[model samples]
Target: MTRTTTVRIAMNGVTGRMGYRQHLLRSILALRDQGGLDLGDGTVLWPEPVLLGRREHALREIAERHGLEHVSTDLDAVLADPDVDIYFDAQVTAAREEAVRKAIAAGKHVYTEKPTATGLDGALALARLAREKGVRHGVVQDKLFLPGLLKLKRLIDGGFFGRILSVRGEFGYWVFEGDWQQAQRPSWNYRAEDGGGIVVDMFPHWEYVLHELFGRVTSVQALTATHVPRRWDEHGKPYTATADDAAYGIFELDGGAVAQINSSWAVRVHRDELVEFQVDGTQGSAVAGLRECRVQHRSATPKPVWNPDLPATERFRDQWQRVPDNGEFDNGFKAQWELFLRHVYAGAPYRWDLLAGARGVQLAELGLKSAAEGRRLAVPEIAL
Candidate 1:
C-alpha cells in the first residue's frame, strides 16, 4: 500500500478575500468536509491548513466560523511548529516578501498569490531564496485553471489552431463609486503602497495565461490611467486613489504571437464576470469567457463573403458554437488551491512556479516603463 503523506499548511493572511477563498474555505475546510480528496494519479493526499493572521479577533472569528481550532496571530509561532510542512502566503503584496522569507527560513514549502513581491528584483530574490533553501515554491496563476482558459489550453495543445496568431483579453468591472456611506470594496487594492492597482493585481494572471496559451512575452508597450481619484471607505471616510484604474498593453511573444491585455475597474461590463479572451489562429478561432467557450474553425462549412453592413446572420452568428461544461463548476481560485495541495503532497508537477510569477512582474514593470516613457519596451531575458 502506498503511504499517504499528510501535509500541514500554515495559511498566512487567512482574513483577506483571496486568502479566505483559496486557503481557508477551499484548502482547509473543503478538504475536511470532503474527507480528503484524491489527485488524478492517486498518489498524493489532501492537505490540512492551519489559519494564521495578524488580528487575534479576526483570526478567532474566522476559525470559529470554519470550525478550525488551529488559528494564531503570531506567525512565528506557526513557523516554529514542526508539524507545519507548507507555508502559504496570501497576505497583502507589501508584506509578502518578509512573510515568504520567514517561511523559507522555517524550512517549509511555500505558495502565494501572484506578484510574489512588489517588483521584479524582489520576486527574483525570493525565487533565489527558495532554491537556496531547497524548498518547493509556487504562485497562484488561477486563470490557467479557469474552465474557459483550460478549454483554450486543450485546443492549443491539441493543435486545434494550425499556427497561433494573436490573443485579446478584456477584463473589468464597474466598481461602485464610493459616496454617501457606501463602503469601499477593498482598500489595499487601491493604494500603491499596499500593492493596489489593476496592473499589478491582474497582470500576473494574464502573464501566466498568455505564456501558457501562446508563449513567453518578448516585449511590451502600454498605457495606464487613474480614472477615479477618490472613493469613500467602509467607515464613510474618503481616501485618495493612488493607483492606476486602467491599463492597456500590447505584448510580443517569443514566437511572434501578439497579445493585447486590457484591465480596468472603471468600466461597466455586460458579461457576468467581465473577463474574456479571444484567440485567432491560422485554421481556427476561439473566444472564452467565465462560463462559455465559443469556437469557429476552418473545418466548418464555408459561407459567403463577410459584408460590412450585414446584420446578425447565420454566416457570422452561426459560425460560433458554445462548448458544454464537463462537470460541476467551482471558482477557479478554489480549483487552484486543491491542485496546489495535491501537488505539494503527491509530487504532482506544479505548473505555476515563482519563475512564472516573476515573469508577470517583469511584464508589469515593462508595461509601466513603456507607459512612462511613451514607447515600447523589450522584455529583458529572465534566467529561468
Candidate 2:
C-alpha cells in the first residue's frame, strides 16, 4: 500500500456560509473527526486545513471553534507559508480570479467554488495560469456529488435510461426578503456589480450535470426576470435588486437531448426540496431529488386513463418505486470538498475542471444574451 500524503491546506474565505460549512468545518474537521477519508478506489488520507481570512476576529473565532492552530488574515502570508500545499477559495465570485492568480503564482494547487469568474475569458485565463504553474486546478460542481444526482448519472451510464430525451431541472427556494428582523443574505449575491444572480450563480451546477448525464450544451435560449425589484435589509434599509431573481433556459445538446432548467428565488415547492432533476428517456423516466430517487418505466405505464365520470382504475401511481439511499450521504458542498482534497493529495482525476466551469459561464452569458435579444444564442466556443 502506498503511504498517504500529508497535505497542508490554506482555506480562503473561511468566514462565509459555504466557506465555513464545507472548507473549515465539514471537509477539514469532519474528515479529521472520522479519522481519515477513504476516497474510494484506494485513496486514503486526510487534509490539514489552515483557515485564512481578511478579518482577524472572524478568523480567530473560526479557528478556535474548529480547534485549529493555524489561521491568518493575510492571504499573501498564508500563500507564502511553505507548509500550505493547496489554496481553497470559497470567496464571493468577484474575488475568485485575483486570489486564484496569487495562489498559482505562489505555486499552490487550487480548488474553488464555481463560476470561476464573472466571465468565461477570466475562467479560461485562470485555467491557463494554473497549467503554466503546473498546479492542479478545479472548480466545485457539487451538484454532481448529490446522491440523487449521482443515482441519476448512474442510471444514465448504465443504460437504465435508454436514449434520454429530455431533462427538467428545478432549482431554488424563497429567499428571505431580508426585511423586518431577518438578517441580510450576502450582499454580493444580490448586486450585479458583485457578481450576484441566479443565472451566474447556479448555471455551473447545471453545466456539469448536463455534461455528465447527457452531453455538452450546444446552444441556449433563455429569459430572466427580477420579480421583486426592491427589497429591505435586516435593518429595514431599502436595497435595489440589481440582479435577476429568476431564469428559465433551454439547452440543446449534441445528441438531440434537450434540457430545460428553471432557477428562481421566488418559487415555492411542496412535493420535495427546491432542487430536483427529472429525466425522461425512451426506456424509462426518473425523478431525483437531493436525497431520493424514483423511477417509472414503460413496463409500469398506466393501463388506462381514469375519469371522474367513471370508476377509477389508475395503477401507475403504484408503479413508481423508490430507490433506497445507498449509505451515508454528505451535503453536496462537503462531498466536493472531500473530493478536492483527495484529488490534490492522491492525484485523482477531477472532472470538474476549469474548462467545465468556463462552459458554465459561457452558458450564463449566452442565456442573458438570448433573453435580451429574444433569440436562441449559440454557446460561444471557449478556448480551453
The number of the candidate with the highest lDDT is 2
How many Å off is the CA of 25 in candidate 1?
1.0
lDDT of 1 by residue, 96-211 (tens): 98899889888888988878988899888888888888888889887776788778777888888888899998999877766854433586678887888888888777778877
Question: What's the CA error at residue 380 for candidate 1, in Å?
Answer: 2.2
Off by over 4 Å in 1: 1-5, 39-46, 180-184, 299-318, 326-331
Provide the global lDDT of candidate 1 against the true structure.
0.81
Residue 372 miss distance in model 2 (angstroms)? 1.7
What lDDT does each candidate get? 0.81, 0.81
Across residues 1-384, which tens digit of lDDT does each residue of candidate 2 receive? 545556788888889988887767766777778876786666567678788878889988877876788878889988888979989898888898899889999999888887888887788888888888889888888778788988877777788878889999898877777775463367557788889988888777787788877998888989999987787755678899899889999999988999998998877776576688889999999999887889988787566765779876554546788877767777777777777776776677787777777888888878878888999988756775
Q: Compute the lDDT of residue 107 as modeled in candidate 2.
A: 98
Each candidate: RMSD: 2.6, 2.6
